[model samples]
Target: MTAKVENRDFTADLNNKSSKAFQDFEREFKQQMAELYQSITSYRGVEIHSLRNGSVIVNYTVLLEVPATATANSTVQGISAELVTIVNSYLNCCQSNPACGLCFNASFTEVTSAKADSVDEDLCDGQVPEGFEDYYSPALTALGVLCVTVCDKRAASPYRCVHGTCSVERSGPRCECSERAAFWYLDGSCASRLSKLGVAVGVPVAALAVAAAAFAAFLLRARRQNLEYR
Candidate 1:
């Protein structure tokens, strides 16, 4: 993107054009481009600059990032040759079996980008998530990332925490609910509370269940004694 090779996206131009041949291959062209991408694994991507001259002329560039084993095999060049062929084929392809003059042009640009396997996993620059305010994520520096998203925990107020308190941690902000003795908060929001009446009623019902089991055991014992006497 920094290179800014093209003025604008040319695919958009083809989409707006009112040409019969363009309309015929519009869907297949996308599929063909995707298939082309699947073949090349070492390069950056195919940057389509513009598709002009009735969708027959293609202007594009492929960015190349050098590998550790540079040119060790012919995989890169072989695929590049196929890319040229496939792109040209898409340009001339039409459903009506009519000839539409099409040509393919590609520019190869070498970029000194990061290694293919090294991915930046740090999310220190990530934004404060929804329902949180006062984003204070540390900017990435040469040393390392200090912290990720840090919401305003000092005074999160009724806006962020509602009826709870907020605290910042490595994983971001957490909400601690504050509920009354006879009530408990629902979920972690602490906005809604349910009365402890159900808990109070459950105690006696559980005791009754135990008493019924004991009575059944005594009746079984009595029946066993009668059978022995017989």
Candidate 2:
């Protein structure tokens, strides 16, 4: 059986698709922001559901999974970066525009409270590690009123093959892959592709070579036996 090969060309195709996916995300995010801005005036009392310390709690629950691509060339990172930019811009606007105070304060408080609640829930669930309260409390408190909440699915690298598998890492908001599986470290995902492809190709070739050698040996023995009988 010629190892059922699904043309690896799909890698490039998948990369293209991934790029398009990210582009779509960017467009959708912008559209959503435009709508959010129009609907929720900056002066309106927008309640912040998750605030801790000074920083607003950015809950990433809104965006869960980013579309994966075979090559990992996606617009997810760019879109996420853009989102950070938007958040920063919004925060700056809030700081500069006194009219934004009411909305900003409310949102900030809500975010902090939500984060506190999340921490509390984690503790109840036993998800909070030892010394976590001490570490998180001060950090959360220090965030204070002026802090910003960056809520997004997660930051990720464009290359997926370099990263063996995608999972959430505790260090900030990014998808993480195992060290052994990762090609490079950037937002927890691997960034290399050439190395990953090399390994994938090498394994199949090695298997084919072993099979060929065994077949040749069997053929040689059969030929010798037939000659001796003749």
Candidate 3:
């Protein structure tokens, strides 16, 4: 629908995470746009930077040239909104693992002139982090990027769970502990929850055992002395 031109610039202070995320955003954005709108062209690259609040900002420009024969929503604002929604959803999904404290905002500009800067590095080398597929699929599906299928329902105001299994419902994903689940599921993995629980429970039991053994020894010694005296 629209001619797409992709371009990006990153300052020197960008970290590995922001760098990787910027690359992923560009690649995913293009694919998502292609799926949602069939007539995009001149795919520009992306610019990534960090904010003082640990938020990552990604800004990009794409030229949308929708053909008269296409069927999807061809307006620039509509495509821009879709792009922002998908990017934000993916960023949210990324936050599920390792608990990255990142907020994302994307702005799209209509490409008006040719730029001299060019970014030609490999942007698609990294793989999606674990535990995000569950979040990623449904979010994109909600927009028009992926085809629809049965999805895990989100919860209604799911409690933020640490070191626990998360329940999927309509509201959002919530975490809970299973019968054998370890403590601190909030950290994503069991980590030391089971061991910590064991230590907590075992220390008291051990102390009681030692106390019982000492009492039994005292009784045995007293009995022996009384018998000898008799």
TM-score top scorer: 1
Tens-digit lDDT string for candidate 3 (54-145): 23233335454432221333344455655455444433334334343233333322333332221112211233344332333311222323
User: In candidate 2, what are the lDDT values of residues 1-230, reduced to their tens digit?
Assistant: 00111111122222242466334433443343454345322212122122122222222222313223321223333333343433334432344443332122322211111111112212222333443222121112222211111222221222233454542234433444555552434443455433556668889999999999999999999999999999
Please give the RMSD to the true structure for each candidate, in Å. 18.4, 25.3, 21.2
TM-score (C-alpha) between model 3 and the true structure:
0.23
Candidate 2's TM-score reads: 0.21
TM-score of each: 0.28, 0.21, 0.23
Per-candidate local distance difference test: 0.48, 0.34, 0.42
Candidate 1, residue 189: Cα displacement in angstroms equals 5.7
Better of 1 and 3 by lDDT: 1
Question: Residue 104 in candidate 2 has what lDDT?
Answer: 27
Predict model 1's lDDT versus the native.
Answer: 0.48
lDDT winner? 1
lDDT-based ranking, best first?
1, 3, 2
Clashing pairs in 1: none
